[model samples]
Target: MGFSVRALDTDSWAAFAELVEANNGVWGGCWCMGFHVKLGKGRTAQQNREEKEARVQTGDTHAALVFEAEKCLGWCQFGSPDELPEVKSRRLYEKGLTTLPDWRITCFFTGKGFRGRGVADAALGGALAQIAQYGGGVVEGYPEETDDRKVSGSFLHTGPMSAFENHGFTRTRPISPHRWVVTRTV
Candidate 1:
């Protein structure tokens, strides 16, 4: 089964929302906003949805959304450091971070019933293609390594390290146990 990729913008917001909504707003209503901004106290699912839509409307966010004939399969969110400043393991990442890359791949989602079907690979490939279209540069991704362990799909939102390696990203350093910073020139 092949899937097509599209940029996340006003035109594809509905489809993106559909995927997230079907998954109960994703990450407990994160809407994949975990990297974009800090959803502090008083943040609601509706707020996240609205904020994400607002960002999409103003071109403040970017992602490669995968679809199988109009139904969204999943997405891989990528953006500039400024666009997405709040990353997981912030302290550890900053400790090893010398400089920021041109782009950062922070989030990914492979819809329910579609896990392990290469959706992540497709979404990742699509993201790189889109980044190239936006002017290729150094790209970085933080992914967990699931070499011989069973990790719940729900917790692998940042994607698997193996996928990044398959996409030409070399391991840079380990930020946490089982998680590494992967980089590619793109």
Candidate 2:
């Protein structure tokens, strides 16, 4: 089966909501706003969710979601280059990040039964397409990977190295052995 990706706008509210709920609130009802809350800064869970929802309502181009049939299988939060404090604060990212307008795939979450089945890969590819359609050429991602260690998908919501690499992202730098910034130019 194939999955489709789309923006989490007003039309996708129900699907998006369902997607979040089905994930056991792994993101603390974040709506994927952890990076949007600013690095080195703090905000309540409700605050993050509210801010994210407001951005979506105002048509902030940085937010997105992916769906497979009636089920939303994946999400890649992107757009808003200057607005994403997490990526902006990274020293490695600070050094040679593109000045051109870009989209940041800050986070992802795949449904339980649909995981490890290429769902995130499809969603990310679709996200790259959406980024291009939105006039974005540089799509960025920061993902974590491990050889055999076990971790919850919630903890790995930033995604994994294999996922982005399989999608043609080049490793720009290694933030750590397990974490790296990977990017794909489209």
Candidate 3:
């Protein structure tokens, strides 16, 4: 079957929730809100789930969902800088920033049995296309450069450098030892 993608809007909420639930709420119940909101101390997974669900219901969150014949297989979260407040290695990323990007690709999640299947790449492409529909602008992403080393899929939730580059993003700067700030003018 061919892969397809869609924005994670109200109509697609059910499929997106199913994908997150299948992954154990994503990164210990992050619900893909790690960059969008700061988790207070003692925040429960259920709370995070509730908050994310609310965001989806109110059309506050943005993401691109990858699917194969109607079943969502993965997703990539993208939004404006204000929409996604904090990111990994914020200090380092700030040092390299000449100007704030119009959009940021913050997180990615692929289903358990769907890793290494180009789900992330498809999602990234989908995200760029979605951004274009809103009038294209600079899109930034922080992804790891594994350098052929052994790395777990869980550690690549933000995605990998190669995937972003393959989608036409250039390495703008190094945000961390293994992570880079990449961008593309969409």
Candidate 4:
């Protein structure tokens, strides 16, 4: 069957959370909020999870999820400009990174059993098309590119270089040796 995508809603949070934890547990509990939320000062992992869920529920329709038939297969985080403080607050921003008023693609997670079936690519394509439906502007993705010889889940939260590039994203800047800022101007 074909892969389909939609914005994650409150009703689907359980499945979404499950996908995150299941993948994160084996990959290390990144929780997908490691860089986005402050989990250090005093908050615990559980608290961070709650906060992220709350944000997902109350925040604008930003995050997109993919499904194949009845199974949730992948997810891609996207939304308006200010929704991603983690990326905006980075040192790269201070160094003159351009900002678009539309949405940005920040994180991606393809479920354990659905990694290499073109799930991520299909989800990303669906996300871009969905956002564009409402006049979404340029889409940006900053994925990490670790040595292919030693690749693993932990090394790819933002995504991989070839994935974004294949989806029409071009390298805008090198955020790090492994991470790069990519953009597709609409």
Kindly give the stretch of ten consecutive residues in candidate 3 with the minimal lDDT sum.
Answer: 36-45
For 1-186, candidate 3 gives per-residue lDDT tens digits of 389999998888899889888889888788888988887689878998888889888888889999998899999999999989888998888887788999999999999999889999999999999999989999999999999998887778889988998999999889788998888998
lDDT string, candidate 2, 1-186, tens digits: 666777778788678767766775545566676676652346665565567668778876354466777778777767656666665337766665556336678877786777887777776777787777877677778888766798767657788788788888898877656777777777
* Model 2 CA deviation exceeding 4 Å by range: 39-42, 61-64, 88-92, 95-101, 148-151
Lowest summed lDDT over 10 consecutive residues: which window, candidate 1?
Answer: 153-162
Q: How does each model score on TM-score?
A: 0.97, 0.82, 0.96, 0.83
Model 4 bad stretches (over 4 Å): 24-30, 98-101, 146-149
* Global lDDT scores for all candidate models: 0.91, 0.70, 0.89, 0.72
lDDT winner among the candidates? Answer: 1
Per residue, candidate 4 scores C-alpha lDDT tens digits across 57-151 of 78554566888766778887777656665673378644756555366787788887888788777778777877788686777887877656578
Between candidates 1 and 3, the one scoring higher on TM-score is 1
At residue 112, candidate 2 shows an lDDT of 72
114, model 3: CA deviation in Å? 0.8
Q: In angstroms, how far off is 116's CA in candidate 1?
A: 1.9
User: What clash pairs does model 1 have?
Assistant: none
Model 4: colliding residue pairs? none
Scored against the true structure, residue 167 in model 2 reaches a CA lDDT of 83
**lDDT digits (tens) for residues 95-150 of candidate 1:** 99999999999989987888778999999999999999999899999999998899
Which ranges in model 3 have alpha carbons more than 4 Å from their true place?
none
